[model samples]
Target: MRQQMLNNGQQRIGKGLQLSFVLLISGALIVSSCAKIEPVVINEPAYLRVFNNLRFKVTVDNQDQTHSTLVMLINPEYDSNGIPAGAEIIGDFLVTRNSYAPPYPSHIGNSLDVYNPEYPGKERVNAGPILNGFDLSSWAQVPSGQHRVAFYSRPRSEVPFFNLEMRYRTEPIVDTVLDLRAGEVYTLHVLQKDFNTKENGILLRQENFHKLALADSLVYVNFYNMSAKGFFEAPHTVKPNSGNHLLGGLNLEYDWFQEGIREEMNVFYVAYDERFLRQHYDGTIKPLASFMTHLKRDTENPATAPYWSLPLFFNAQDSIRSFLFQEFFFSRPGFDATPESFMIPNDGPEGPGAGGYARLLCYGNGREEPPAPRRQNYVAVPNLIVTTHSGEHNPRSFATVNSIEIVNNSVYLTTVQRVYEPPVY
Candidate 1:
C-alpha cells in the first residue's frame, strides 16, 4: 500500500513538472496592445525524437568516444505553485541502442499482462522498461516554439532521477533552448564534435515519415556523415562499433604525411540473390549493386560538406536461397571505381588488411530471421549501426530507411514501416 502511494506521488510530481516546464519556457507570451508580443500557442502538435551520440570518456580507436547513457531533465526546479522543487524526468537511462517511444494517449498505459493470446510469442513475457527493442516511452509534447532542456550523465544504478543525490552529482552535458516548428517532426542528435576540447553539440534535423510511392521491393536510404571534424583525416586504428567490438582499420596513414584521400566513397552491396554468390576483395566476385558518393570533408578542412540526402536505389526483396543478411562497404577510390578490385589497397580485413575499407553498415531485409545473437537484427560489420530509431530494420517486403544518421564511426537507422493497418487521424 505504501509503495502504491509512492508511485502515485511520483506521477503527480511528473505532471506538475510538465505543466510548469511549458509555462516557464513560454513565459505567458503575453499580448500587449501597443507592443504586441505574440503569445505562443500550440494548436496541433510538434513531434520530437532524440539520439545520444555524444562520445565521452570511453576510448575508441585510440580516441575518446561516447559511451554514456543520459537522463533528461525538464525544468529541474519548478512546480505549478511557483515553488522550486525536484525536476521532472523525461528520458531516463537513455542509451544509443534504438528503442521505440511514440506519443500515446495517457489512458493507454503499458502493462506486462497486456498480451494477446492469439499472438503468444509476439509480446515480451517479463518485459520491464525496454522490450523487443521498443519501450513504453512517449514523446513529451511542448509548444512548438522554444523550450529549455538539459541532459545529464546518470549512473546505471538504483538511484532514480528524482533522488537529490543523483541530481546533485550529475552534471549537465547538453543545456540549451530549442527552436521548434509546429506540425513538424524533428530529430535531435547530440554528437561529440571534438575530442581534445570535449565539446558536444546537437544536430537537429527534420524527420519525415510521410509515405512515399515506391514498390514493395524498394527501401529508401539516405546517408548523413556526422563524424567528427577530422574523421576521414584522422589516423584511426580501431573505433567503437555496435557489436561487442566492430571497428578495425585497414590503413590509417593518410594523415601521417598529409596525403589527400579520394573525395568519393565507393559503396558496394549485393541484394538477396539466389545465385549463391559471394563478394571478395580480389576482384573475383562483383557486387550486385554499386554506387559512389563524395565523403563529407572534415569541418576543419577547406572543402565544404554537402548537406543533402542521397536516395540510393536498393532492392530488399527476398527470394529462393536468399541469404538472410547483406554486406556492404565504403572505401576510397580504386582502379576503376568498382568495390572489389577498384578499391583502396588493403582496405578490407583479409588481404593485407587496412582501415579505409572496414567502414560499412550491414543490415539486411530477409524473409526468415537469421541466426540468434544479433544486434537488433543487424549483423556485425565494419561499422555497425550502433543505434536505431526503429527496430523494423529488416522489413520483410523491403521498405525505405528514411533517416540514416552516421557519426564518426557509428551509424543509426530509422525506416519507413509499411502500413498494414493504417492509422486513422
Candidate 2:
C-alpha cells in the first residue's frame, strides 16, 4: 500500500508539471494576441506648388477653323495598371481671329479642368473657379520630387476623354522632366514653336514674389532677353548725358551677349531725376543710337542702317515701379514678317514702286545702302496692357514681372500676373 501511494504521488507531480507547461504556452499566446499594435502614424507628404504660364490657341484637324482651341497638362506618374496618373486642363482658350496680324488674335477663356483619377472617363473636377488664362495667380500642389510634365493639344469638346489611351493617344507635343522642390514656385511657359504644326514646347522660369521694401522715389528694372536671335548681334554702348539721351549710350555688347533665358543682366536703378522725368513726359528720350541695331535682312549686304531700337518704357504709378524693354522680334526684317502676310496672296513679285513689281524691292540689290538703308522700314511698336486688382486696398499693389514666349517665329513678352503665396499644399 505504501508503494501504491508513492506511485500515485509521482503521477500527481507529473500531472502538475504538464499543467504548468500548458499554462505557460497559453499565457504567451494570450499576451501576444491581446498586445496592442501601435497604430502607424504616417506623416503627410510635402508638396511643390507649380504655376502654369502657358497660353496658346490650338486648332484641331477635324474641328472648325474658327473653333481652334487646345491646351492640356498631364502628370506622367503611373499606377499599378500602368495608366497615366491624370491630366490638368491648363487653358481651353477660343481663338478670336479678328484681324490678320503677326501675333494672330488674343485668346479669351477662363474655364480649366482637372481629371478625376479615381473616376475614369467622362468625369472631371474643376481645378478652381474658371480662370481667364492658365491661373498664374494660383498654384497646383504636386508631391515634391521628380515628375514628368506633358502638354497636349486637343479640341475643347474632347476634354471628357480622360483615359490612359486618350491621354497619350495623340502623343505629348511637349514632354519634359521636372525635379521639383517642396515649397518653391516655378513658372512653366508652354509656347507654340510653330503655330501651323503641333510642335509645342515649354520654358521654365523661377521668380521671387516676396514683398519688396521699394522706395517711392526709386524704380528697379531688369532686362529679360527674349530676342534670342536679335541678341546674336553685338549691342551698342549708351551712357547718361546732358542731352536728350537719358542714359548715355553704353556699349551693350556685353549685355546682349550674356546668354541664357531670363538671365540676370544689368538691373538699372533710376533715381527720379528731373531730366529723365521730362523725357517721359515729352517722349523725347527715344532709344539712344547705341541701343539701335542695323539688322540686315539680306545676308549679302554687309552694311545696313539701324532701323529698330529696343523699345523701352517706364511706369512709376503707385505700387508698380518698373522699366520694360520690349524686344519681341528679331531686329532683322523680313525673316518671318507676319504670318498673315504670308497667307495673303503675294500680289506678284519684282516691282520698283507701287503696283509695279520692283526686283530690288522683293530682293535686295546686293549693294550696301548708306547709313539707314532705304529698304522697306519695319519698326517695333510697344503694346501696353493695364490690369487692376479688385480687392486690394493699395492702388499701387501691382508688381513687375516678365516672360519669354515663342509662337511661330515671333518671340514676345508674357506678363506674369501674380506671385505664389504660401499654405498651398
- Best candidate, TM-score: 1
- RMSD of every candidate to native, in Å, equals 14.7, 22.3
Sum up the clashes in candidate 1.
12
TM-score of each candidate structure, all chains considered together: 0.55, 0.38
Tens digit per residue, CA lDDT, model 1, 119-230: 0112212211221222222233344776777866655544555563533334577788777776555566666676445576666666543423444343445555566554
Q: Which runs in model 1 stand beyond 4 Å of their true positions?
A: 1-43, 55-67, 75-89, 98-142, 164-170, 209-217, 231-268, 274-285, 297-326, 334-337, 342-354, 359-398, 421-425
lDDT of 2 at 139: 39
State, as a TM-score between 0 and 1, how close model 1 is to the true structure: 0.55
Candidate 2 Cα errors over 4 Å, as ranges:
1-73, 76-136, 156-158, 163-170, 192-200, 208-399, 404-412, 416-425
